[model samples]
Target: MANGVERELVLLFSEEELREMSGVKRGGEYIEVTCGCTSHRYGDAVGRLRVFINGELEITCECTPGCDEDTMTPAAFEKHSGRETARKWKNNVWVIVNGEKVPLSKTVLLKYYNQASKNGNGSHRSNNGRVCHRDEFVRCNKCNKERRFRLRTKEECRIHHDALAVANWKCADMPFDK
Candidate 1:
């Protein structure tokens, strides 16, 4: 946005999809779920995925040191990419269709927000306050804006974060180059 507000996209999924990720398990806890071993553009595997008792998902990107780490609502965890064949487990928008996976609009996503759930994702940015970096968001004090830098190297994000933390940067300065 011109104002520098990050675009927060919270995906939604079907109930069946949640069951698939969680495998019809216990309740009220973060159950460690297996995530794809796909090699991220930056580095290693995609890290871990967890489902809360209330049907929320927590994902961490094992791609890099400062990779992805965030929680998703049941709705997002259940969305089927509609492109999967044998349900190749994913933590993002794509879910399994033959089982549980479907798209829901903003109104539709919010509608299900009120449903009772254990360890639920909670609002899941149904309002705002979600980041947008590495698939998660990062902030910049100098620009007074928070957005993705798309830094090529893992060190870039770390440096950018450090610069921001130490207030050693100016909005006019580039974190490095491009």
Candidate 2:
């Protein structure tokens, strides 16, 4: 009877279960486990099979059984998830930052807007009242120094433009050049 009970227990866990049990569990609040070709489990699951950290589900799996457990806070989950899947384009546009897709928030859009407004009209217009034909001739509005302001359309000196824009927007008014 004892021998039969042991044999039954061995048969209960299928081959797949045996493989999963053998695989490594990389422990972390947010861990990514890959079972290589030997295992056919890869899919994100939240709760239950997935474990959480700080009161929120942080560890997402690409495995089949789905995730179980809750351990991270909502804030931590968002932060971790965002970083895991951030992708960038050749054009320097971050298609995804962290796991969240780009353009989902105002961060990228605001960056684009500020880049477009960098040179102000002054740099575009030459002394003759003609638009500067050379990209390098445009003077940064903030620094009053000439640079290849091709990347940004605003008049800010490359170093100060982003900071100025952020300050201006935060204050609900254009920042005074100090």
Report every candidate's CA lDDT: 0.39, 0.32
Give the per-residue lDDT of model 2 (tens digit) for 1-178. Answer: 6565445434433334334322223233321222111111322222212222222223232324443424442233333233333232112121233343232122221221232243465455545765553333334455555433342434545534554444323322333547
Question: What would the per-residue lDDT of candidate 1 be over residues 69-132, giving only the tens digit for each residue?
Answer: 4544333333221223323333333222234433222112223333335324332332255532
TM-score of 1: 0.25
> Candidate 1 local accuracy as lDDT?
0.39
After the best TM-score superposition of candidate 1, give how far the Cα of residue 61 lies from its true spot, in angstroms: 2.7
Error in Å for residue 148 of model 2: 26
Q: Which candidate has the highest lDDT of all?
A: 1
Candidate 2 residue spans exceeding 4 A from truth: 1-92, 95-98, 103-108, 125-178
Instruction: For each candidate, give its TM-score against the true structure.
Output: 0.25, 0.15
